[model samples]
Target: MAESNKHLPRLLCLHGGGTSAMIFKIQTRRLQWALRSTFKFVFVDGPFTSGAGPGVLPAFAGCDPYFRWLNPESQTAEQDQRRVRQLLSKVIKDDGGEFVGVLGFSQGARLTAGLLADQEEQNAAEGMPNWKFGVMLCGSFPPLSLSFAKMPSTKPSQGTDEHGETREPDEDEIIHVPSVLVRGTLDPHGEKGRRLVKYFDPETAIAMVFKMGHHLPGAAGDTTSDKGDTQKIVDAILKVYADHLPYEELKAPKTTVMENRNGQLSA
Candidate 1:
């Protein structure tokens, strides 16, 4: 590895539903290439396989094997949550460094949002690493019943109660981490993406809209290969890291991280 990339901060890259890490990697090749110098992207396959599910992306039509972070048919929300937490923990341990950030598309983005929210509610003693920021590309918010949905608000709100006296509302749960939400104007899930953004603090979240469809576009209106769009995404990712994590932390060694089915960590 080049000296500049030797200590580059690691970012967990989550693939969309019905798309494996390998597939997503290819899908976002240009963007990833542009960002490789500044960040080490770790792409992981989701736990559930997409078996003839309705509404799966057309690109996965004959892919034979596809994956997802959550499977409503075979797993409950709690089970899926535990699986994600374990996978992240194992990856961090295997890498010999903590994940500075996360970048996800579609279902993966949704999972990332949920994870960040969950981290907000956790006690420091739990030993989970707090991600500095996240990039959610076409992601959605998890159900309110999840732990991330319970994050207590640190900011005060100014509003009048039923009594007509001005006062701050009770501390409500909110994800405090800064996030960049990327949405395609033509995507059917665009509305869901908007709803997810509303869950975060208005001041901390940034929403970027592209002119294309469901997938991560390379240019303003091009879904596949637009150098300009790729650079924009790359810039957005780097900015989030720069605004949050220390520069010194970005220069950490890369190591092998893996987890067994039992959730035991090993390198």
Candidate 2:
């Protein structure tokens, strides 16, 4: 796709729980073009196998297997933390272009929040620079609570390494990033979902909600919504990128007129 702004920051799109990277394109396509010519979008599937989510697994359209970070164990925050850390590492490394921030939905939104939190931590460790952009939709926090591990087998599986030592991820680690969290008021998980945003420091965290549901909330076909929705989310992300970009040097794309049977702006 044509990039809107050459200097616009790259926004890595992440998918939510019960979803694959495919769900992102539909909502982001217009926003990608509208956000300035250089702005970029890239979507990533999570790191968990879909066997965990039933029918949702095959939705990857027969691509290679995938992975996700979910509540794997009960009575321990380790499982959630470990999985998020792994995910954060992957997103950073997978960032082929400049990673200004991230955008995600449902389970993806949870990850986006996690990534933003992690980024904030990074900035703090590296001496605080403005980090945190991108967007999230529906769902919130760890998609579902990791504190509620449903599987008796949810504990990290013991697998053999070349040396055969138990190769489970380290627990005690925390992944924190600074970013936005959006939720639909009517979503089953929406109210509690706000907790997702509270995990971040108020100075860094920006939370918003809509009267909508589990999906990205917005007016049926408008560019933005008073309630949380993809367009509003993307706009927030762009504002973050533009804040970093040379406003005068990076020009937003000008509207181009399409010719119908006659050369006229379609009304």
| Whole-model lDDT values for every prediction | 0.64, 0.50
Please provide TM-scores, in order, for all candidate models, with all chains considered together: 0.73, 0.57
- The number of the candidate with the highest TM-score is 1
Candidate 1 lDDT over 1-267, as tens digits, reads: 445565777888888877788877777777667777777778888777876332444655676588877766853565665666676667777876556787888878887776676667673213346788888987754412224334323344355344222332233446778777877667777777766776677566656766656777652245443446555666666665666656675532222222345322233
- Roughly what TM-score does model 1 have, to 2 decimal places? 0.73
Q: Candidate 2: worst 10 consecutive residues by lDDT?
A: 143-152
- Tens digit of per-residue lDDT, candidate 2, span 1-267: 444344455667776554556555654555665564555676666655554332243344454354455543336565655555555446656654566666777667665654444443342212112344646666454323222223124446466443222333233222334445666556676654655555544443445655565555442343334433455555555444454457696543322212244211221
Ten residues in a row with the worst lDDT in model 1?
251-260
- Model 2 stretches astray by more than 4 angstroms: 2-8, 36-38, 51-67, 71-95, 123-131, 142-178, 201-205, 218-231, 243-267
